[model samples]
Target: MIPVKISEEAIKEVRNIMENKNIPDGYGLRVGVRGGGGCSAAGMNYILGFDKPKNTDKTFEVDGIPVYIDKGHVMYVIGMEVRFHNGNDAKGFVFVNPEIEKELN
Candidate 1:
């Protein structure tokens, strides 16, 4: 199973983007953490992009989408869920971590 789970809505949008953007073969979605992430209260911010798997990466095929996670970032995003929001306030994928939500409470 993937360390991070993606919601169904996010999956559909990602597939559309991959087709429209013409993402190259052998390249897949990369999920990772960026330090001091803005728009989030978590210790690290999550990032999504298309990239070729690196030697240090672990790959997962989720619903026909290839996902890559660098080893060092695995722990940070474990159990996290990625959702797509297309409301008036936001129009993007939002990362939600249950652990972080608990801490915030």
Candidate 2:
């Protein structure tokens, strides 16, 4: 199982993007943390691309979608739920990581 749970909406949206972009067969969704050194909270970033897993990377296949996550970032991402938003306020994947939320609380 993946370290995090992905919403059906998110999966559909990702697949739609892949089809539209004509991403190659092996390209997978990349998920990880960024911007902690200078920011109050670290934000999640997503990239639709291809890259081999590093020695310190953990790989997971969720609903036919391959996910590569760095070992160091796992703690922050585990148990999170990914959802896609296309409303007026937001228009992308939003991460609901309980770990970070609890920490900030």
- In terms of TM-score, which candidate is strongest? 1
**Residue 97 lDDT, candidate 1, scale 0-100:** 79
Q: Which residue ranges in model 2 land beyond 4 Å of their true spot?
A: 38-52, 98-105
Best by lDDT: 1
The per-candidate count of clashes, in order, stands at 0, 0
Clashing pairs in 1: none
Can you give the TM-score per candidate against the true fold?
0.86, 0.74
Residue by residue across 33-56, what tens digits does model 1's lDDT show? Answer: 988755543658789999999999
Give the clashing pairs for model 2: none
Q: After aligning candidate 2 to the native by TM-score, how far in Å is the CA of 45 from where it should be? A: 6.8
